[model samples]
Target: MRLLIIAPEQIPVPPPVGGSVENCIYQIAKQIKGNHEVTIVSLYRKHLPRTTRVGRATIIRVDGGSKSNYLRNAIKQVKGNRYDLIQIDNRPSFIRAMKQAFPNTPISVFMHSMTFVSKPVTTPSKAALDLGRANLIIGNSQSLKRTLGSKFPAQKHKVKYVHLGVDLKKFHPSGKSGAKPFHILFAGRLIPRKGIPVLLKAVQIARRSVPSIRLSIAGGTGKPAYKAYLRQTAKSLGIPVTFTGGLSRRQMPVFYRTGSCFVCPSQKHEAFGLVNVEAMASGLPVIASKIGGIPEVVQHGRNGYLVGAYHRPEAFASQIVKLAKQPELTKRLARQARIDAVQRFSWTQTASKLTRIYEGHLNRRQG
Candidate 1:
């Protein structure tokens, strides 16, 4: 099968830093390249070539001054290429044009989050029309599928969920565990929805019991004001915190190594907590909110604990303290977390499942 994966014209494929959606496209393409002929079309990056071969798959980068130009260039690049399947990542707007370009092909829109499917980015009716056009619609988690279904019931039957994965080998633990100066790690974009302020408060409260506890947030703060506010909030709360800025994908393992435990105190519902999976793969137990798809991965008392009253800092802090006070329990949970990641969530498995879905659409078309 020949698969053409179109990444949003924003980030380059195999990007240097945290490009969750871009990285997912590359990882899935790489894993399935052996069995299926794959080609990834992404925006041009200065450091990367216009066309390059990685393993058996091909990557084609196009000019991307803006979304429309990037889309036009990408369509121009793959104008006459024969593909068994075409996958568009995170862009509902591309669906109409892509369908017009490849009228005979099966096009699927893979949503990494709800960002593109709702207002501000797109209107309900427009998103509905675009998504309804796809042969298949995929979400990264059941929580996301359910949520989207609630909003767009007419297209619910077309929507399916596939959990994103982690590279187990790259993120494996260093076989080291320490609790002397316990580190609480949070990894994600520094958005208000991520609940970083709540994390700061949680750390402040947890410090009373675990005085050695400190916080490290490893992500880029896109806005200067938000960065300043976070720092000021941490300082005011008397919490010792370090904003590690943004670390590249290569640097993530080292950041994971510095943590005693990972926390995902999101104020809103998550689609699929990919960062939590990465932390778990790195052998750091997760303490995250019970809402959304998080509970599906964290599994209270197994790999990590899930806080019910997620918005309350005290709820998160209590879980943080639980892990802090019981070093042996922490190590046990950490070990199991790694086991869960390896057994359940791996790039190879993610590729296989996604391939099965693609083939399903293909077979139906043939019939």
Candidate 2:
């Protein structure tokens, strides 16, 4: 099969910065190359090689002036290519352009998260309707499917849940068993929606119980003002929190391995917590809020603790304290989490499942 993948311009392929969607595409392309011809259409800010090969797939970088122009140029590029199957990552703005460009081709839209809900309520419903055109819609979690199912009932049959995969080889348990500071790590965009302030408040409470606990935050500030507010809150609370702005994918394993527990306290309806899976694969027990698809990833007492989404600093702090006090339980849960992650969330398995979806679409088109 000849496959053409269209990805957003905000992140590059084999992204220098960390991105789950880009990483997933890179992995799937590499795995499918032995059997299928894969071509990736990526965005370029400045001048780049128009055509090149990354791993096994051919990469085509297109110059897009703005989001609108990018999608237009992408449509133009695909119009000239010969592809049996077309796969596009979630970006609502490109829906109309994609439908117009490849009206006859079997197209599949893979949703990392629904972008339409992020917009204003007054906006027109074209984006939601355009999504219905795809032969298949792949969502990263069951919650995402339910959300889409409610929003676009006509296209419910097209929507299917296929969770993203983590690289087990890259993320695994560190054998270091020495007495270390109770290091807690948080990795994600420092945005208000991510609920970083809630984590900071919980850290303040945790410090009262476990004075030696250390919190390290890794990720760039998607909103600079929010990051500043978090810093001020931490200062006022006298919480010992270190914000490590933006670590690359290579640097993430070090933070994961060193930390006793990984925390993701998002307040929004997260489609799937990719960072949660990454932490599990790293053999680190997670402490997350009981919201969105977080429950699907973190089993309450089996892998780690899940606190209420409401502002319960004491409750959140107690979970951290409990983990700190019981090192054996923490270690056992982390080990089991690692095993579960490796067994269930490998890119090989994800790609194989995706291949079946593509084959199904191809078969339907042929018949």
Q: Give the clash total for candidate 1.
A: 0
What TM-score, computed on C-alpha atoms, does each candidate reach? 0.98, 0.94
How far in Å is the alpha carbon of 23 misplaced in model 1? Answer: 0.5
RMSD of 1: 1.0
Assess the local accuracy of residue 192 in candidate 1 as a C-alpha lDDT between 0 and 100.
95
TM for candidate 2 is 0.94
Predicted candidate 1 versus true structure: per-residue lDDT over 120-235, tens digit per residue: 99999999999988888889999998988888899898888888899988998877644368889999999899999989999999999989998999998678899899999998
Candidate 2: misplaced stretches above 4 Å?
Answer: 45-48, 121-124
- Superposed Cα deviation of residue 277, candidate 2 (Å): 0.9
Pairs of residues clashing in candidate 1: none
Clashes of each: 0, 0
Clashing pairs in 2: none
Q: What is the C-alpha lDDT of each candidate?
A: 0.90, 0.82
Q: State which candidate has the highest lDDT.
A: 1
lDDT of 2: 0.82
